[model samples]
Target: MDAKELIRALNARDEAAGPDLLARTKATGPLEIRGELLYAPLVRNWYELTDSLELIPAKAPEWRPLQCGIDERAQAATGYLLALAEADVFSGVVRLSRGEEILFEEVYGWADQDRRRPNLPGTPFNVGSMNKMMTSACVGRLMEQGDVRLDDKVIRHLPGFRPDITARITVRQLLTHTSGMGDFFGPKFFAGGRHRLETIDDHLDLIRDDELLFEPGARFEYSNSGFVVLGAIIEARSGCSYADYVREHVFEPAGMRSSDFPAFHELDGQAIGYTNFTAHGAVTGPRRPHEDTLPRRGSAPGGGYCSAEDLARFGAALMRDTLIGPDVKAALLGLRSDSGSGRPGGVPYAHGFQVESEHGVLSYGHGGGGPGISAFMDVFPDQGLTLVALSNYDDGARQIRRELRRIFWPAA
Candidate 1:
């Protein structure tokens, strides 16, 4: 019934499950958990081992599975994460999917303290800039239908796009963050230095006085203004508001019913984002509501909420050809430069996703961060796997992604 007993049974099942995409040994090589390699012989291949146990119970009803179909590794991970959640590190969900099928979907931590409600599988958490991926998807669909192309110049949609030094910027440059737009947000937009700006025009107006950081497409500079502009272009081109276009085409097609670019006041079961401000992990601050965080209402650059399950379904559908056609999907995953210099380069920013190659496998997804929350969802095409993690508190989803990557896909 306990984790140890479940692990032993799972070990037996794993040996028989045969070769899986998840490495059985040294999968922990690339990842370190609290200064130690997390995967050992004792807990390698946890997913299969645990999944096999589930199958056996269904096949033989006479024997009752004492545990609730959860494995030791999951229990250990949950314990560690819940400890962090209680300490206000974060609250969200972690979901694993293989193609169109979800293998594991679990929620952790409280959605709110005032209501004393814990986050369940369907609880929604804001994805922040991670919503850029969805914006990109809408753009890709437009391309698929010949409404646009990556090479199209921004001026095609917005004549004012090039009124200054931005005239040569292309759709691809904006999507890849290669536009020469300044990374700085205007001082007029700052509210006590929290970096919240409202309205697409408000964002553009903030940056309007600044000169281009570099020539268009010459190098990469992450500019939120670029996607804000893209959202505007989506609206102008689609003849609908950017949010409505994405909700109708991208979210609906992907079966992500729980996902939306909702107003802050509209959200009912959503968790407010939070950030920790301690080394010993004591003091914490919740992210002010988006309305309080931004100067504008709802702009396409960011502001979307979704559950882990919904995100996994979205990723699975994208990989399974339910969203776009084959040619469009290829364009979506192709590697392009993301000129983020502080981190390692060579990661490609595709249509609405990041194409990262690790251990001879391609993992594509985006991470979202807002005032207080962080979220990440990666789809591993080689293994037909998708891993999604959402955190109500800042920095929580990053650790979850790093840890679960090892647990589900250990290095050989």
Candidate 2:
């Protein structure tokens, strides 16, 4: 059924599923919502569900590159993306790469629909929690410098944390999302004054007194606050702000000139992020710009910007060990936790990266987006391939990423 019919069904069938699903979606940190049809990052991707609106409840949950003569597959992928664009279902960039050479690239929709400013190849899109990988790399750098250790307590690096809460957390737990720390985004984040959270300290100040949701190393959970704490720790130990550290160590060395934590007010050339969910997450609402819901600037946990090319460059750097030393790289990319809570089957996580394995082939990457922002990046090390999909429309990159995955990888 269409959205209208589906809403009718939901109203007759249940009353509170929208808010519950919205809460779970917000907890994903990127705040991804596509009206009644939303998906959580990493934890849940969209599905071809039945017409019954499956609204009651639930929980949440890739491919190859060039060098092959797969014209039909390539054309099919392009057609699917074009259909999404034509139907106003997507607005963003989809880039598939084979090593340094691009295999398929497409730009869709307007960066500013009113001014008719179309999103260009270099247009920076808010990458949401994908920035966690960058934050993870900064931690790795500190580890290599011997300034921090995986076993180090949060209190060791960030003494300002409540000892009882922090003593139970470790650098490794934070990286692997087993820290038992919850996210910083919820009612309080959107309650107001988020614009004042311009620095890591500002965000940390908000979560310093938080209660741990579980014991450290209890299990795998996607904790945006955990990454925020990592950002603060990076600043405290390296004596450099997280942004500067990323720019110097992660972006510059990887040739990612267009990636950085630019302030929301200064988003002149960046894509204007849009969303359908209110801060309260209206399951069905008119579309709106996504900036007013943001902080003054992006933080360690998420809210950074990057172009498709730069994102691909960053992925390549991760695979080449340019972002961290060999040992750290190997450890960070190895599957560290079972991520099959309600997610796609057989998916596991390693530190900050999401691992997808099928038919004895492995792909490492992360998905980031929420509301008016959608992005996905993956590197098939065994195949020498990379995929980057970014969008300013609500869950814009999701469809492109999903369809491409069908072309590149099998269900088995």
Candidate 3:
């Protein structure tokens, strides 16, 4: 097949590109094609070409959020969310701010279905992978304190943590998902095994032996295992557990009183996650409590809870160098890697943030979604805008975010 035709087929997921075809397509180099996985710019995501000739979406587009209010000019945005709420699709909070001014804010749906408790603007929702920002900040705090360096080997802080495998990985690589460590998800993680892992140190037992996917500092791959190791390093350097370190250094300083990796049982009146996702990341049917699909609690990689206000506080603090220093924040948010990491082309992964520039507008943020949780927060530094959307229903934040984006940045 021709190069263009091959790219079209791969993107459509209708025709599989074998090794010979992939090599041929790479030689063409006309469509920004990468080896093994296809980087389809049109889709703004990466797809893995399995041996069976099936194309699987590796990750979703990793950027964009918005700020606006309900007015005649923004009726579409407001109506869109109201429509979803009417359909029982949206359940959580949407907060938008320009500096200290709240441009828009609202809450909808039930926090507790059985209790008939409605969601409030203050309700905390599990932010699937959004916790990675704080994990990054934790590492940055240590970096500022001279307790760690990005280039230092992971084995330095976590010497006993898979020394044979971690010796080659660096702190920067781990933060940027370039450490080559795969995720801990499997039948074991989804099955009854998750309950046994309550603490960050306990998760070391869950890291698979066959975790290495590529050489250190190679291509970018989303890794829960890498963050797990970073969490361990945070504990070792701070002379305390990772949770304690984050609470004292990351959250308290940032005024994120409502954010933390609280366990399911420890939670009090937080919005319960409602997911349609099964263990394998597939939607089964209607949304329900996602307790069965969750780990015992959130950890370094993600699964922390936060309210929109708390997240706004975090974004502000992060930008203002409240949790980390100026140079540290800039270096962490700088484009450090540009491998095929499922983000839009030219939008590389920063330390923990995803940096993007579209239509001459620069923004950085992170998104997390799984089953009953869909959370996203973005900061538009030039516009002085911070947008946060947190939800309890399965993939509920997407529509809200898209509408808000259109409302605020219509041409984008």
Candidate 4:
């Protein structure tokens, strides 16, 4: 069926199932809502009662990469990307690079809309969950130094770690999002003063009494609390703050001079996040300020700020082994879980990176979103292509990356 027909069928099914579909499916298994396949226990019951139709799974299109020269493909892709950015009202900095050569770089819209401060190539934007990659890199360095082990339990490093809930969670599980830990951002996080969550330890309080979402390693569930625990482990083992450890080990070695996890009050050239208000595929109201929507400072799970150039530098550093050893780098890029299917466009999860595979070509990176921020960094290692986009407005970065992928990997 066509896209419109498929969407209509899905919506009709959803409406028939009512709001209790999720709850009803809990007894059987998690709902899998891929194209032409809707497997929910409650829906199955309804389907068994009706003999009029049968559900047949549709085969996914085979993906293959287009054969093309790297430089020629990149140049052609740049024009399409620029057009997509203009059409989408993309407000951010984007940089495309091949090895050490920058193929294209541009900035759009305002950093501070009220102040009329236009976003520059060097302007920093908050990369929400991309900080997890940096955190994992820091852990990898420690592992290389024989300071930590992936199999080590949380209680070994974190003195105050709850034995009941986190006793079985390993460093590897935390890195891979296989840990059963829940997130720190919830009702408690929002209701509590943002100023109180300035440090890793402070963020811990939000999840201190929470129960495991599931048995450790039983399934993959993205947990910000897991990363927070990882940050605390880094601090405890290194005898330094998480920020200081990353700055010295990851940022310095990667040549990310302008990137940092600074407090909200310390923002300088960073963009003021604007919340997009949309209705019926069109912008509706004036964008709202994103200041009060975030924590006072960035955390291990995410919220570090960096320029597009610095993000590209990070990808280059990883490729050159400036931050991690060969073994750790391999593990970081390796597929650990297929967890991010429900949101963020279905990218698979790696140790700390997001793995996107199209046409048998794998790209390793991460994308992040928050109140008024959207950021993405993709590293196509085999192709020597690294694309970084950072935006101050929510939902601004993905389309540009999507267009770039389509242009460069036409067959995909």
- Candidate 4 lDDT over residue span 43-73, tens digit each: 1221121222333323333434447765666
Candidate 1 accuracy as lDDT: 0.64
Query: Model 2: per-residue lDDT, tens digit, 1-412?
Result: 5434544455567655444434433333222345544443332354332355343333333334433355666776678777667756678888877657887788889998878899998888999988988887888888898998878888998776778878778888888888888888776788775767899989887887788888788677779888988998999887888899889999999998888888877877889887877745554444678877787789788899999999888888877888898787766776434221212234677778777675577887888877788898988877777888998976777645655766655211
Instruction: Compare the candidates by TM-score and give the number of the best one.
Output: 2
Query: Ten-residue segment with the worst summed lDDT in candidate 1?
Result: 56-65
Name model 3 segments beyond 4 Å from true. 1-74, 280-284, 335-347, 410-412
Q: Count the backbone clashes (under 3 Å) in each candidate.
A: 7, 10, 0, 0
Task: Give the local distance difference test score of model 2.
Answer: 0.75
TM of each candidate vs. truth: 0.74, 0.83, 0.80, 0.79
C-alpha lDDT score of every prediction, in listed order: 0.64, 0.75, 0.75, 0.74
Q: How close is candidate 4 to the true structure, as a TM-score?
A: 0.79
| Candidate 1 local lDDT, 229-332, one digit each (tens) | 78878887888877789789878888888887656666688776655333233232343333444433445667678888788888888777777776777765
lDDT of 4 at 221: 81
Please identify model 1 stretches exceeding 4 Å from their true place. Answer: 1-76, 184-186, 192-202, 276-291, 295-298, 335-347, 410-412
RMSD of 1: 12.8
Give the residue spans of candidate 4 off by over 4 A.
1-88, 277-283, 335-346, 410-412
